[model samples]
Target: MEQIFKWLLTVSGGVIAFLFGAWTPMLNILVALMVIDYLSGMAAASMNGELKSRVGLMGIARKVFIFAMVAVSHLVDLLLIENKIEVGYLAMSVVITAYCLNEVLSIVENAGKMGVYVPETLTKAIAVLRSKPQKEEEKPVAPSTLEVPAVVAPNPPIVTAEVKKEEKEEIK
Candidate 1:
């Protein structure tokens, strides 16, 4: 059993090394963000009483796709290197950064849905990161002009304390 476990571990390590070379800090951050996003999504769903196994499975599949794309990007980088191209993992960086930003945005949204207070500046920063530049002839809408609704809980908190206080004041 120990020998089998060791063999499995070695194979898994080999596969990961081939997929992502050296496990750079950026890749580590991307992986961390992916996990945080998924957990936050599940928390939000549970809070809203909307947890579904199908949705969770889909989320897991999407996360796997994200990593797969990252692996593909790394492979592209390797290809460029083999072709004597001077570009330094540009494709991989772009792909990973984009996915990381997306995961961050999803995490923020999930936190908001779960009634956590997220700063406006942080959300705006994410929005700016998400926006693409328009062509010279095209006009871009300012971020300030966008109307974002406030994140409110589906069920408001009961007013028991406030109502009782008001009743006491009336008696006084």
Candidate 2:
């Protein structure tokens, strides 16, 4: 049984590596972004009382569609290589990059819809996706990492010896 499981896993991994290129950081980021987008969408929808089973399934289908696009692009890239075209994964890279930016934008929108304050950097990603300006040269920044804001009390309560003593007596 263990051997069978290992064989299945190996076959599955091989198929995936072929359908998509060997797993790389870029692909990993794309997948992570997709998951975040989907979860955020659901959260935002529930917050708005707009959650529905049908819609949720549709979202899953859309994510699968994105994966299908990636796979098709990879297949095209493979075909090009077979023909000695030597495009070097250009099609696959383009599909993945486009989807990555799209996922980033969707996540930001989902956050906004959920009444979350999107970090400035993430908002800029939308602009970078839409278009860019050549006004000034600046160092390129990586995509913004999501961080849930921590809740802090407006004013922390102070503990005093008198309060502690009174509370102890009340407990008795």
Candidate 3:
């Protein structure tokens, strides 16, 4: 039984290393940044009273996709090496660097949400990422849709101020 456990562990480690490629400094930084970005995001959401299980689950799924991308990049790198493509492992480096930049941006945004004054350049980058070009016909909204709009009564009462005394008496 102990030997079986040891075999399983060895296989698992081999599979992981194969999928992740060589653990370079760039990969190490990417992983650390990813973790920090995720935790900072959670903290930001919690502070804003926006934390929800579904969103958290979605975040986990996104992180899984990130690793999947890394694996795909690594596979491409392997192909390049095996075929003598002369690309020199650019795929993995590109993937890792892209994700690291993304994580850094997210961490900055999270810090901003948590009331930390980030640098102007970083805030501008966040704003650029956040902004969407609105359509020409789009309208601005009242910030909160939670406030109920006014509803009319089923039957409104008749106004009597303009009615003459004779009319009032007749109605009575």
Candidate 4:
């Protein structure tokens, strides 16, 4: 048990070091938003009966890809400008703008799952975000038919399957 605990701690420490080693406030904020968005999305997906590990992992991959894109954009900016301030601002602008939009969208999506209707401003924002890339049109579609399982609490942010069979089906 002690060995297991030590191993877990070492792994956790390594992960933290790797992820935050390049930490800027902007990167920190983005990471926080990413985590919140992932969790909230998982909750919403569960509520809609669309939760799958494969889908969740794909979401994570996409999120990471956004950061990679931002990095590439920064590289381009660096090559173009002699002013470090200009390059920093350009990179920060690209990354922060994308993360801010993503966080707001996640909040609205989670609220929608909780049965809270979004305000028009938020809806418009979401629409704008959706218009970003042509691939945005492939956004995940919520199922038209979903039921609150008897075992799941009415107030749960995520819906839970009542039976093992349903859980198995969901995993598949």
- Give candidates' CA RMSD values in order: 25.7, 24.5, 18.3, 24.8
- Could you tell me which residue pairs clash in candidate 3? none
TM-score of each: 0.70, 0.67, 0.72, 0.54
Query: Which candidate, 1 or 4, has the higher TM-score?
Result: 1
Clashes by residue pair, model 1: none
TM-score of 3: 0.72
lDDT of 1 by residue, 4-91 (tens): 9999999999999999888899998998998899899999999999999999999999999988998999999999999999799898
lDDT of every predicted structure (CA atoms): 0.91, 0.91, 0.89, 0.73
Candidates ranked, most accurate by lDDT first: 1, 2, 3, 4
6-75 in candidate 3: lDDT tens per residue?
Answer: 9999998899899986678997898899899989999999999999989989998998999899999999
- The true-versus-predicted C-alpha distance at residue 122 of model 3, in Å, is 1.8
Best by TM-score: 3
lDDT of 4 by residue, 86-147 (tens): 54447546766777677868778787786778888877877787775655455565777556
lDDT-superior candidate, 1 or 2: 1
- TM-score-wise, the better of 1 and 3 is 3
lDDT of 2 by residue, 1-172 (tens): 9999999999999989889978878789999999999999999999999999999999999999998999999999999999999989999999999999888888888988999998888778666776866678666666585465899999999999999999999999
Better of 3 and 4 by lDDT: 3
